[model samples]
Target: MASFKKTATGWRADVFKKGIRRSKTFRAKREAVAWSNQIEYEIEQGHHDTGAAPPNATMYHILERYRDDVSPKKRGARWEVTRLNQMMRDPLLADVKLSDVGPRHFSAWRDKRLKEVSGSTVNREFNLLTHACKLAWREWQWLKEHPMAGVSRPPENKPRDRVITDAEIESYVETSGFSFKTPPATVLSRVGAMFLFASETAMRGGEICKMKKTDIDFNKRVVYIPETKTGVPRWVPLSTKAIKILNHVLDYTKGTPTVFCVTASQRDALSRKIMKKAGLEGINFHDTRRTALTRLSQKFGPMELAKISGHQDLKILQSVYYAPDPSDLVEKLE
Candidate 1:
């Protein structure tokens, strides 16, 4: 049976048919009656379930269980754990019980969160929540069904392509030859050439920085990136321009195990220093790879760009593809 009554501060609606039921406070008698009516509707719709009280479960307890027991067994689990902890720090979902969590509660949380997040961010949090519920569904076996079983996450927003322009490239090559943009030594000037190498070779900074003479096959013009982002063994071909830039870097780093293996922020500082030094604007080292990918896609095809960029997805290259120049196309045709 459901009931509504006037209270000191407001009206109260209470339902008595479930094992774990909730009562809500309303400001007016009409509001309380409406809430009581909705409660009945929910119960009639079979949304309200009856079960024994859930064992004492807290937000932290679920996180610890998911992180250590479930997450560790999955690939890219560390990132999941990090995201979970960050989401937990949000006050909205912190106090809600895992057992009491329903599609309605999740929807309310999502609606509240839409004000503060991008579509992609909202989708990401929903995905994280879905993943946690999936783990619970597979392992816990205690829950009847995943709370987010039918929840609809927002569509991912289109992300900007990370392409760099030729003017930017020219500025970058000129700057890399100069003094270090940051502190300590003038050695950081290699940042400019580093950007050039990345642009020409599509080599990741970390991989190229760790490259040694033993790893290089100058005769073959192939740099073996023994480890890659996909955890698959792969090779990246060296272009003549890339060879020239790397040769310069090798001359500068004649005796070192790691070549320009500074922290990413330090690399950013070096780039800014070079950008300021060269009197050029809006160029960064990371942009070089994007530039290279974009240029390659225009000249060759998506497959070729994917081959060079180590991207398994051709759609990625297509997304960043800039139109080729007609004059340049005529020259290539000739």
Candidate 2:
């Protein structure tokens, strides 16, 4: 006989006959009922293979397949590969077989991981595993259910609200880490321009650093980003200050095709020097993007802001980047 019941997370289907018992859970009630009916029919007709998976196949195998086949197609393939490597180091998780893995296994792993890393890191790794399990179940038919669907994920911290100030920017650009000795004029100039460009364009440091002359339209005062983090191409309008910075770079590096000719390490080293000189605490290059987006939100609507920022989702822009000033509300009340 076969029966179905609803659980807190989903519907559970159980089949019991001839001293053999089998059970599985589904997120949908109809799926559970259908599974139960199929199993009951199979049992009555004298042919039910018990849905057993190959014994040697394990989570490690599935993750390896995903890494080799799926990760390269993603924009964040390096990150996905890193996560897979991290998971492979866990012996217990690596040895877990497709048929034996259940919600309890994931629950225990989640509890153990939370003690070692930040909740956000664990959340990201969990998402990767969830996708792997979903692919196995839907595409490979290696699993009857997704174990992660019933597991609890760790809570993540809210987006940072730190916005860089103009005075701090000026201090960073001039006499940054040069109290005892003079810094390289060319390097400091490039670093200062990079900071100004990020603040004015709301473009990421990597995007700005890799920019070439062909990506810009001087007549239109716009820079076309061919590849962005979201895998979308966007044309970012240049501010007057941004144009001046580019013009200065052209005068300095006359033959270089790249707007910023410095390497990432060079950029980071200069950023550290500026931070030390400015005596600024808890500010980073990314904060410049937050500050630019917050200021721009006041002048542009969501659609225009999305176009300028290359944001696929406005909710992310509203919640994470747009830091509304409380002083504006106070002024209105006054």
Candidate 3:
């Protein structure tokens, strides 16, 4: 049963049916009648949640669950946890009810975030909120609607298109002493081999840094990537030069299970030092991936390249890695 009555402040709609009792106050009598009708219909259809979330449960409560229970299991768990921690410290969003948050609230937050960070950085943070709200709706049933549905997203920044030249590669290897080195290795020899291997094998810096000796088979000329950004393991073929580079580092990485046995900071610092010695400006270590993929594209088709590069999306490989010279195309046309 449903009832609508005029109150001193507004019109009140009350529904008592199917073991559910709910009331809503509206400014207009017609609004009150409409709300009561909708409530009655929801009760009849058995689609209502009966308030899946407690009215007092704040956004902090929901984020805490996501941070502690969900994010820790993800590949980017640390990053997700960090983002949730930042959100928890926000006075405006931390205390807001999960059910009460709307597009306007998110829009205001986005505006504030824009002032502090670039559009792409803010967009990544916003993704956390969107994913959290979606999980709450699907798994927890705590949210009736995704709070991010109507919110506008920040525009993503364009991907870097920097090119690494072969001449620059020679300069880098020579300056950093990464080119050719005998055994009885130094840190320069080990990290230098890493740079050469990344350039030749088309492996990401992290993948190259985290490589295990067990994962490499010199007889087969293959490097098995046990884990990748796409969550798909892949086998990256090694060139003769790449194989030589690995062999050079085998003794250095012999005692440890890891190939490079270097922290990310150590690798990064060594890369910076190599760059300085090479007299190269604005070139990152990842440019080696682009350089390798671009060279491989000359010999392999899209599918083969994707397999070698561990790219699930052919479009990404084409756009990010394939930077062919226009003069080559012109020469081919001629």
Candidate 4:
């Protein structure tokens, strides 16, 4: 049961159920009614929590705990850590106490962040925050109710359909300081080989960086990927060109365990520098997957392409990766 009274400052609502009492003061009577009703409902459902979080516990602390205890177990730990660090820097979201945190803070944050970044970026952050809050509410019992339950996610930006060209690929490789005649010996040469190899193999930048020299089966023309974005291992068949590039990289970095000597971050930085030097715009390293899949589609059917690309969802494989030129389709139609 709940009761409300008009106070000098605002409306004060008090709820008592299951021998537990909760009270809150809101600026408006409607707000008080809403809060009291929610409390009563939670009590009836046996989900009410009268205690757990410390008096001064803030969203920052929850996020910090999540970063240390949860994020490291994920495959995208690097990205999650980076995003969580950025989130903690914002005082509006980080400093708010668990009891006082509500949808308004997140709504304000979303509005401000939309001005600086794309909707997709903010949505990713929202996902991380949502999961953190869920854990706090259900697993950690840090909040009486989910704070983010009332907040709506921002509209996602359209997916990237930017396709890379062969000429641009050649220019990117040439600008990366790798030469066909000379063996790949420098880090820049390895980056170049990574770029070319991405086009041939469609392996992600991280996967390429994590590639072990021992994983390559030259006899079978296949490379076994023990770790992947999908968390499932798959054997990616190597093309003749891919094998040649691997052999070139092997000749130089033989002492190292990994094929490519650069981390994903290093590959991204060097790739951006090379792309800028090549005068290319709007093409990212991941675009190589789209380009490679488009080229692979010319020879392999949907099932075979899915196998090679490690895409369990054929619809995603077709919609996102298999980008064919209209002119090429027309040529084939003739």
Number of the top-ranking candidate, with lDDT as the measure: 4
Q: lDDT for each of the candidates?
A: 0.65, 0.78, 0.79, 0.86
> Candidate 3, residues 211-312: lDDT per residue as tens digits?
888898889999999989998999998888888777767765688868877766677888889889778997888888988887887788899999999999
> Relative to the unseen true structure, what is the C-alpha lDDT of residue 301 in candidate 2, on a scale of 0 to 100?
85
* lDDT (tens digit, per residue) of candidate 4 on 1-334: 8888996567878777887666655789999999888878877887755644434678887887788679999999989988887787789788898879999999988998999999999998999999999999899888888988889888888777878999999999998888768977777768889989999988888899999988999999999998887778999999999999988878878888788777788888888989988899999999999999899889889999988888999888888888899999999978
Off by over 4 Å in 3: 1-55, 170-179, 182-189, 268-279
- Model 1, span 70-143: residue lDDT tens: 77876557567777666656666655676676788678778877887888888877877776777666666545
Q: The CA-based lDDT of model 1 is what?
A: 0.65
Best by TM-score: 4
Query: TM-scores for all candidates?
Result: 0.63, 0.71, 0.74, 0.83
Task: List the candidates ranked by TM-score, beginning with the highest.
Answer: 4, 3, 2, 1
- Reference-based lDDT, residue 174, model 4: 92
| Candidate 4 TM-score over all chains jointly | 0.83
Q: Which runs of model 1 end up more than 4 angstroms from their true locations?
A: 1-55, 68-82, 108-114, 140-143, 159-162, 170-193, 204-214, 251-257, 264-286, 298-301, 321-334
Worst 10 residues of 2 by lDDT: 176-185
In candidate 2, how many Å is residue 226 off?
2.6
